[model samples]
Target: MTAARANTGIRRAPVQRRSRERVQRILDAASELIVEDGLTALSTRTIAERARVPVASLYQYFADKDEILLALVKRDTAEMDAAVDAAVGALSTVSVRTMVAATMRAFLTIYHQRPAFVVIWWRGRSNQVVYDFCRAHNKRIAADLFAFAQAMGMAQDGTVQGVVELAVEVGDRVFQLAFEHDLRGDELVIAEGIELVIGYLERHATPAGIAGVSVQGQDGPA
Candidate 1:
């Protein structure tokens, strides 16, 4: 069956377990197709066929191909957010270097686990919705980093937020380069990215004075 919904490209939120699973299968099929054949080969009919569901069932969840892609973007971004939050939370206190390493490692792990992320990120540059989502995601990450820096007494007087934004921007560029050269990511480039972020943070986020203590000198405060 052809998509009967309007061209607005909205998704019908699944409320039941079976429905959610079906929606997931549809998204999985789309992701696999995108990775195997590129975005140009993705279509609602192909996704439905791959998912072993009827075209109508696919429409029940996604209005069209774009809707399906948007849903995938949201799901992937949520997973990334969870990973980053877990990595940040694992550290009771953090230095600039430790924070950079932890966050980069978390992201690289996700990129490795979810190959679809590479497609989504690359497409984000040309897709307005995906682009906006990425920008928002970066802001949230920066905000989280800012809070972590404050908690660790490493935020500079007026540069914590900007520093965090720069770190995110630079990390994104380097990671993109790494993935461009090697799907899983280039180990050498990933290491360089970590160092690049650490250096930038060091320049902007000075250790907050606390008597014979240094944020950069230790893993964290004793």
Candidate 2:
């Protein structure tokens, strides 16, 4: 990695760090362009211009704009997954309510933290690759939640997997709604979403007879 282009503030790169830094610049440039002018503003030319990389160079890494959007989606979701996993993994006393709220909070935090993701995910979700990745993200979260449920002996029924999957589907839409009208996300909608997911889970709660199943959490309360 050499230095950023003086005025444009874009770093220019291919050694190992060089490749990594160039990728970051591309991602960052795409992010800025998207946020500044919506998806319509995104093009390899624009991204390279903003990133200070040549159009030819941008092609070497990403074949098209959709690929760049997908990259941003993947990059942001990885962080979101980490936050949700840590929240669920750290739940010392997991219940449907606590677990749901903690999960919602952690998941929502990502929207606030990554403006680029919030924009790309909502805007680019219709793209085939991004849509597929989004589905995978939902399943991954559901799987993580189900793993915790399994440790709690709530995994007795095959229905548990289905129920958790449903919760994820519902949560994804509700959260999207929360961000729909406002980029910052409407607080009222977020709270309602938390309550809605918890209530939905509570209705399908595994019988208390299975409550004694011991499970140790990662580090903190969810």
Q: Which candidate ranks first by TM-score, i.e. highest?
A: 1
lDDT of 2 at 81: 75
For all candidates, what are the clash counts? 0, 0
Model 2 Cα shift for residue 131 (angstroms): 0.6
Estimate, for each residue in 27-54, the C-alpha lDDT of model 2 and write its tens digit.
Answer: 9999888877888767889999999999
Q: RMSD to the native, candidate 2?
A: 6.9
**Can you write out model 1's per-residue Cα lDDT over 29-93, one digit (the tens) per residue?**
98898878777777899999999999998877777777777677777877877777677557655
Q: Write down the lDDT that model 1 would get.
A: 0.73
Residue 171, model 1, lDDT: 94
In model 1, the runs with Cα more than 4 Å from the true position are: 1-10, 208-222
lDDT of each: 0.73, 0.74
